[model samples]
Target: MSIATSVPHPAVETARRFARSSRTHDGLRCPNAAFDAWFARQRLVNRFEVTPVPFSRLRGWRFRSDTGDLVHDSGGFFRIEGLHVTGDLGEWSQPVINQREIGILGILVKEFDGVPHLLMQAKMEPGNINTVQLSPTVQATRSNHTGVHGGRAVPYLEYFTDGSRSRTIVDVPQSEQGSWFLRKRNRNMLVEVVEDVPDHPDFRWLTLGQVNRLLRRDNVVNMDARSVLSCIPCLPDEPAGGAYGRALHEALRPGSWSLRSDAEVLHWISDLKSRRELTQQRIPLSDAAPWRRGPAAITHPTGRYFRVLAAEIAAANREVPGWTQPLLEPAGRGVVAFLTRRINGVLHILLNARSEAGCMDVLELAPTVQYQPCNHPGRPPRFSRAAEDPARLVYDTLQSEEGGRFMYAESHYRIAEVDDACPLDVPEDFTWVTPRQVMDLLRHGYYLNMQARSLFAALLALA
Candidate 1:
């Protein structure tokens, strides 16, 4: 880690104080009143209202047919198409058309005090309760990120494209898969900058440790930041910083889980696949039992889970915030967790064999838990219980940042560890794997979900 000349940062002391209180080993709690007060002063107010627009009237975009399929474009940037697929829960005749969306999410880091600090923004999206959240340095769509619409410049975009003065930690530019809802994919990156960079009021430089600390609090780090952080790659030979950093490095290092032969892991996967697998059912939106078409969007009959709504955004912060688009809004918070345990002195993460309607493949490895609490209040949760209970060794829990692109999408993320006593006779749908094994799976695509990848990236940053 390296940096340019240091400037006096007023938030550093506050960041350190909060970091000390929110240690991973000690578990997490809300920050003190002073920090809360300071945090409250930072806000992003929406100056424009989002009004629903007809699909035919959408400017700079159009719907076209391709090989009997429908695709959409905004004149420039990536395109969206509907994919017909059925999940394990669906019958052969029922297929859901999942919207395929693609975008970019990147982060810029600089070293401070021999430790890496991330450059984050106090950005706002239409669906946030807090109005603003700590987001990635650069989170934009292909259109905005590429300046196709001729909007304001995205901050720190040059470091990613110019190929100058940076260390690329996570360069996974990939797509996402989770068919129950919105289908999205992004180009994710995490880089360390070594040159001088100007600071802005909306921008703050916080150590990776500090960022993880803030993550414990509600609505702090945004989804884009989490997703990008999860992509960070941890090389076995990389030098970790001070004692604290080394401890983080060691936590992610191979426990007994890594010593297992590849054949054993494959066998485990095989056994799990045969015994337990996720199943889903897809039907026409019109025939969906729980959903209804409202005047402006498709929503749950009870107004729960998620709803699709259109908005007309107007903002000086965006090149064309004054545009209309459709977004998804959730009824309440969602959860994304990674369950871990030490097997033979090696750390093993618990991954779920999840099936999404939009996934190219039928199943992929997901975090231990990724669910909308309001959508399934009666069902017994997955590893969510362990992730929420600090006594269960699940200290990595934190509320998700708002998905600015989404109407109102947010989730909490956690990484919890279970002891042998927790139960070796777990459900067949789950498997314990080493961090390295998971990273290898990442390269193959669709094996790991974006939420899971974000947590892994955060773990790598700790080193």
Candidate 2:
């Protein structure tokens, strides 16, 4: 008999490195305390001002006389159009952002002292509440990177776009908020480099543990960064500290026992997709009923869901020093929670097969509860109360949505460990799955919604 040598795949080695980095909170390049001070200094030094302006006052944007769609003169960025969706629930029409172009949300990784550190940027978006937050290494739309905006070149873009410069660790396209953008997707990439990288004033190298720790804070890590970080394939090989940590670690292990097998979960998703019926049609913005356009904004009659408003922004740190664009402002803050429970000694999270007007597919796996308190008034969704219980709450933090498109939009993201009272048999639309299953599903696009992905990243932080 001939003996064969076992060799680990490159991706597996990369994941191991990431796992090691995740265990080290204080990076050699930038310690957590030093990062906090640098972030504060960046906020103070940069000049950022956002002023509300009327539609007529927009510099390069105007409403089409025929379709009444608010579009840019260059027709490169995004346009506010009307989307009519018809399904079993009912039929409705609303203004949705039509951004057909895909963007790049890439993070660069480099090894220092045998541990990996990610390159992060202190980016400022007009809609962020704090005016600045930690963003990805290169968060640029095709238009911005292609010079459609006629601004300065985006820094550190060559590492991701030009493949020869760095080795690809994880490169997958992921969906954004299904309800807000129309068929939107961004290329979420994590690239590792071997050569020395020049330092920029706004950029810093931090460990994966530091990034996860920042996730616990409110509006510190931006939406794009979280989405990309969730794609990193790293699960602790050994049991983590504490009871909850141990359970979470076990749940994330690939071959760990799960309530539902991989085949069963895929079948469930496919069955749901085949049975559900959704039809959407594009119409002019003026034809959207119950929504009126005013001098300053386009608002609904009762101002329930969201409204479209224009803003003039000036940021000294951005590629473009000044610009004018439209922003979607939600009525109120939203709640995105995941209900977790130890099933058969393993942790499992409850996910909902939620459908939205702008989803490319009819349904995507969403959080246990994704709703705006203002929109639902007295009628709260199921499992929300359990998730809000102070005693059962495991992790709770306020996170902002994509600041470039949404104005002051934030959600209270929570993870609660429910008691056995919450039974395993849930509604037809909801199902329980382990973290490993969720991570496996993430390898393919559109399986989990943006809110769920963000919560998954938060869950990993717990381990």
The candidate maximizing lDDT is 2
**Predicted structure with the largest TM-score when compared to the true one:** 2
Which ranges in model 2 have alpha carbons more than 4 Å from their true place?
Answer: 1-10
User: Once model 2 is optimally superposed onto the true structure by TM-score, how far is the C-alpha of residue 457 displaced, in angstroms?
Assistant: 0.7
**Each candidate: what lDDT?**
0.57, 0.90
Query: What is the C-alpha lDDT profile of model 1 across 166-193, one tens digit per residue?
Result: 7665565554636434445676777677
RMSD of 2: 3.3
Q: For model 2, how does the per-residue alpha-carbon lDDT over 113-153 read when each residue is reduced to its tens digit?
A: 99999999999999998989999999999999999999999
